[model samples]
Target: MTTSPPEPGLHEGEFHGGDLDAARRRFPNAPAPWIDLSTGINPHAYPVPDLDTSLWGRLPQASDERALAEAACKRYGAARPDMLVAAPGTQTLIQLLPRLLPQGDVAVLSPTYSEHARAWRREGHTVREVSDLDEIGTAKALVIVNPNNPTGRVLPVERLRALAADLEARDGVLVVDEAFIDAMEGSASLVPQLPPSAIVLRSFGKMYGLPGLRLGFAVARPEIAARLRDNLGPWAVPVPALQVGAAALNDDAWLQRTRVTLEESGDRLERLLKGCGCEIVGRTPLFCLIAHDDAGTLALALGEAGLYVRQFPEHPRWLRFGLPGEEAAWGRLEKVLRPQGQ
Candidate 1:
């Protein structure tokens, strides 16, 4: 399917992935159609069911929410469906968690998602971005993005269990953003026995290739889940999101096939990057990080060639590439990259 492109603009400070609608304005000289490889969203989206007109006419029903939650629990391997809180998206939960959860000196695993730290700070909490667990000394709360974005580093579940235990003792919560963990084979998920003080976030859109659906989940103890659900109020997730999310989650065959395809594509991307003299610094099946001294210039060149990849200004040496998602896109990327070997 030919997917619509994400809005484009300078990603200098805030997230430049989905919000920018001014791509033509920023890259005036570039071609009309832009290929966006900036976000880790799966390019091959789940086939959306032809939603009934009544879905649009009426407000969402409670039964619809329950069904979606049930599907999510089965999909996520969670025994406690009561612990699931369906929200507009994980981004909404990210911002809301800070206000609802206990306040403490928060430590986020650094060089990961910018939103985690930003959310806490906006709520008047002191947030520290730390690379080492030991560096998080005396910090009551901790946040980590598993199979971390940009750099696909994963911390083992046992270590996180220990951290959760420690935080629970201190009355602080351990927030694990497993947004990209769905496609991971033998995923190190902290579910089935999610610690009393631990809250795990799951993204429905990334693995299923339906980010536009704006569906995501937060799993925690019933108490935390209740707080999040109540605060989000009634009909937080729309009828459309609920329908598609349920359908996709139950489609195990699609999940299995997509994982295999993404892995193959990820390997192909690695080889392509290597041929262009880029060091494959980090990766998950969804994205690859290229380490080159002049990554900024390389990114600019790719952008000028009408491909939008993600670049972290703070980490100028790294550029993250999502899958091209089509044969033509692969050809275009190869064409642009072959000429400019790092």
Candidate 2:
């Protein structure tokens, strides 16, 4: 495991969806159209409820947070009131965790989110990788991304609970970033378990396709949650985000339909990628990590043909593909894979 964190700062053409904003600006007239396969956001977004600006124009009030918290608990079956803390996005909560924990060493599961290690190291903590929980030792904190980003490796819930226990024994915090769990069949969300030293981060941006709204939440013991709230300050969630986010979370029929669509689309993507001679590593309900020695080149080729896939700079050999929304997208992608000299 690399004791030092990987290079920080965005690299050129690194395909996280948010990069599209810059891509569009740079390539005002790229030959082919751009299709974003970078971010693991659901292509189909939930229907945003009619916005009542008056209800949300001001900064989020305490009553508003309480209402949203209740909705989340009811939706995710959070058993306790102290378990959830809403944030502007899960990214914000994640960046804050290391700062909130007592000064000590930090261990992050590698080939995971770069931000986890980056955030810890940025705070002057020694960040290391843990392939398994045992490697965490008596560190100040252990961070794991359930259905880990890019890799899409979903750690079994039992293993996670055990790992949390190990960290707890050392009086350390266990932070589980469950950004993709909502797309899973049975999520291993720690939302219901608000253990004193455990924190779980959930993102509404990914599944709900409301990244523009910037909404997410943290689940921790009330005391920890209170500290996070105090540190992060009041009005963390804006009124528009709170109003629309609450409405979106309450839509059961939409949730069911979206889940079905994601499963089917994910299956199609996996099959298509396999047929293309790419090595499939692991996958969740949302995306899959694939490896080819020439992933960067292949991504460029796909981009030239109008598909924009994500490439991790550290692992140039691996790429992450978001589910293509329509068969036409896959058809075009497949067409690019045919033998050139045939």
Candidate 3:
């Protein structure tokens, strides 16, 4: 294999995580069955129920889609099930939101998800990457990733509520992406307290460990949700997605148990990384961010060793690792991080 530098995080859109196909191609000579620690997706996934043979042949019924919406509303503590709309994934919603809203200046609190800014810009809006809320200025729309991705920095609900109020005055919208909030402790979702001019997006895949299913939702005022529904047309969410998403959302025992498990796993990861001579910079339950002066070289080494982790181009010193699910996965990571002789 060539000893060139790696670009593991970039998919067609921009830099994010869990692109194993890109990883495998980048490190062609790395061993088979690479351990992906790129995204903040929960390693412990929700158990999917058995599907009927008929589900595949028949188109999803409107009622089944409604059931999924209700399950999501209850699961997220949304104001009303009618206020929710199911899409293929938050990526779809992320791209769709900018098109529906009046095109103008959009302020995204960054070093967060890159997709949010890119989506608005693609729709002909001036997008600004602001460091803090004070820099938002007169933007018509604001996007925030709650319990943020790599940094795991979370804003209080009150602060967010006040921001929503400020945007509402401008007839603007606040788009809060709560993709990682399921595993995030101490912070509450904005869905229940969803403001009049605010739109909250939820990712079922990240929390459920089934990003492949591509199910997600948007919680908003009834009119805004209706607008999204109209644009998306019929059958935006398929039958299997409806059935599986509803089942997963309603599983209380699994949800409660997983929350506890993720917290414990997060602490375990902290201990593991620290023991391996890495400094833990930030973390949510599903992933941890590390700061190393030589993160680029380290990332290249990890890539060569059949481990795919997220390395940000903008912040060259930062590296992000997702939780490894199984015991063997953890051992593989440890083996690579702490070689036998060391």
Candidate 4:
């Protein structure tokens, strides 16, 4: 399988109020909507913790920024402090990776997040895509999305270690974007393996259901981390985001509860989709990837019935559903797309 990066025009939670507005204009008396499943986020979002008012007013400076990152390292079990860097979101770090590693050919595992390729190409670098890590060219920079975004595939850590060693031998960079690894059964995280040629990116958005809060981090070798810091510059994350991220990361009890919820929800999702004659492909306790011959039609029918699901343009046959919150939403979905013959 050959992997190319995600093309543009594809996004999680894609919808235009403009489109809805147009639909409303065409049919002003349409029924109101209830829930959205466009993005693979937990519908039972973690309660937004109340923050100190000072967090909103205070400007994030270098000292507080360092503290925030250091706290994250501890939370993730990283011993070295220099390996971590905080950013507004994982997207910022992915976008900056191309600029940071300017001189090499980049290879990305396919059916993964599109941002990786999009960022590289925008910086005038051509990216090679591969379906499996074995097919990836020995380019100076190799990027992989652990528990991959769209397909939800997770690569083994031992395989990544071997790959990293090979890349290091060629003076290459091995970037493991672990954006969704927090939800995996056993993550092949490279946090314990940070060095000059190794890097990992993590997102707090998907894990904590705080996408609007926009918190993420990158772990790399000391020198490489410094370079990323110098290039990306100061005020990397706003004070409020930093505060919330730190609080959430430290809340181990909450995280465990969230994981349990994800597992239960994912099981229900699998059964529900299968009941509708859809095939389950890849999944974690957090989200599931499913395929149908006509995802577009299914998406429209579901949306028209007041349930919004995400449809992919590049892979027209697939649809990704976020874990729904209530039995009512599930009931609505079942009513919208009942069993093949019942």
Candidate 5:
């Protein structure tokens, strides 16, 4: 495997979690069967139902897309079908929104997801990284990742609603990314109480643990949704994604069970980390962000042991751990982490 020097800035997009090939080069002699706990993706993915042969043979029909959107609305509690626009992924919408809207100042919550800032900047918008919601004054657009990535900070709905109201007066927009909210309970998703000036982005892959499927939705008012649909043009989502996402969304039983299982798994992870002398700073059920004085050293150590966890260059003291998929994976992680405590 080829190896390159790690890039400096967080925006390189070259150092995201779950790049097993990169890990292999970094730890070429570590071991076989590396345990990947880097990304927040659920280890237990949804079982995709079989697809009709016609879905593969022909172009996706308008009705099939409509059915997928309808299912997403029902599943996500959107006010109307027209309010939601399906796309290949939420990442696509992130890159598209800045171009669709008029150029203006965009404020994003910092030490969070880097893509939002990168997307806005790529489209020639002035981007500010605000540490607090109150610091978003006069910005034409505000982006927040609810149950935030890496940190898992959840903003209250009332605060977001008020922010939306304030932004609406200036004809600005508030974008909430709910990619990690599916496994979280009592989350204040902007979908149900979606404001006219606010657009909420949801990822089907994160929640369903099928990132390869590449399905996501943008929940906004009718007009904005229509504009996004026009920009994406026809047949944006694949036929397999439409059918699979619909089935997964409608499976309430699996959703409930997965939530419980993830919660238990999170608690188990907390115990393991704490037992290994790591400080648990923040988390969602899907992953835990831990603090260590030398996180880079620890991450390197773990990588050498064939256990990969996420480390943020922006925050030198932090490392994030995703849940192991099975008992063997969990055992492997525990065995690797035990030496750190010693």
Candidate 6:
């Protein structure tokens, strides 16, 4: 894995995956050819077709944007194309949402993505981290990451809709981040039943394995989406990203096959982690969260062997393992972890 510096503007305790430089600095003696399973991104990326040279020579057209939105709406089950606001990525939208909405108390489901809390707090909103959705009482805004990152906890759609209704009655809003939901079958998304007070964020990178393309969407009432679109300006997503994303979203055949592959890969990952004496706690099709008495130690051990897994400092017993992309990567993980089970 090539090394790069930590991303600029990262808050304390907001470390992300895919920081190979940090891994290298910490484990200098580790061998080359690092197996990076730190991020829950698909190792197999969608095949982006060759783009026309005109895509580069000219500014992205309004028609191209419309096509991309239409494709995303179809893929994500949004009510209409206008309901979706294309952005550079969900991370950008996450940072902008608190600013777009009225300032008030914001409750984020805890032990999940830290950015939701950080973004709200950054926007001067009173932030509360709650473990249960029922505990979110009276907050003006509620944020949830469905099939949550690192932990992989999934909240039922029925309960989420009920909460949205309750919040809407009080003039509040519910923001759902469905970044990992793409790989899960029969998962409920808020986009199809988008209430005026509910906003849903969808990621194009994780399931498609093209995080570099930096494409994502925000599905909500047209008014809210319009505001987000305005904030993002006229040409938020690059032309190449629009072309690649539109084609990938419209490819139903590839989506179906990839879903099955991710499920099988997830099962294989779960078994490998279990075999290493890690107790499985939660999982999604792209990753597994396992518990161990000394997760930090295990993470370091794996890192020193040129295998990088994710560890949460706040949750010392937890470690997250993303699916390996290739057979060699899986074999390397198993080889390094086998001694732990003994």
User: Where does model 4 exceed 4 Å of error?
Assistant: 1-31, 185-187, 339-341
> Which parts of model 3 have CA positions greater than 4 angstroms off?
1-5, 8-15, 339-342
Q: Looking at model 6, which ten-residue stretch has the lowest summed lDDT?
A: 3-12
lDDT tens per residue, model 1, 199-267: 999999899888888989999989889999989999899998999999999999988999999999999
Stretches > 4 Å off in candidate 5? 1-14
The whole-model lDDT of each prediction reads 0.86, 0.75, 0.85, 0.74, 0.87, 0.87
Q: What lDDT, from 0 to 1, does candidate 3 have?
A: 0.85
Candidate 3: give the clashing pairs: none
Error of 1 at 3 (Å): 31
Alpha-carbon shift of residue 107 in model 4 (angstroms): 1.0
Roughly what TM-score does model 2 have, to 2 decimal places?
A: 0.89
Judged by lDDT, which candidate is best? 5
Q: Relative to the unseen true structure, what is the C-alpha lDDT of residue 273 in candidate 1, on a scale of 0 to 100?
A: 93
Steric clashes per prediction:
0, 0, 0, 6, 0, 0
lDDT of 6 by residue, 221-320 (tens): 9988899999999899989999899999999999999999999998888887888889999999999989988676777678889988777766767878
Q: What local lDDT score does residue 299 receive in model 4, on the 0 to 100 scale?
A: 65
Candidate 6 has an lDDT of 0.87
User: What TM value does model 3 have?
Assistant: 0.95
lDDT of 4 by residue, 1-342 (tens): 232322232233233111334333433443566456656666666677787887777789767776777778987767677778888888899899898766668899987777787888789887888887777776888889887877888777778888888998998889999887776544467777555577899888888887888888888877888888888787878988877777778787888888888888889888888888788888866678898876666665665676655566767778787777788877787787674314
Worst 10 residues of 1 by lDDT: 1-10
Instruction: Report the C-alpha displacement of residue 162, candidate 4, in angstroms.
Output: 0.6
| Cα lDDT of model 5 by residue, 1-342, tens digit | 222223332112545787887788778898879887888999999998877778877777988888898899998899889998999999999999999888899999977888899999999999999998778879999999998998999999998999999999999999999999999777478789898999999999887999999989999999999999999999899899989998899899999999999999999999999888899999999999999776677777778889878877667678899999989898888887788788
Task: For model 4, give the 10-residue run with minimal summed lDDT.
Answer: 9-18
Each candidate's TM vs. the true structure? 0.95, 0.89, 0.95, 0.88, 0.95, 0.95
Cα lDDT of model 2 by residue, 186-224, tens digit: 657766655566788888989987788889988887778
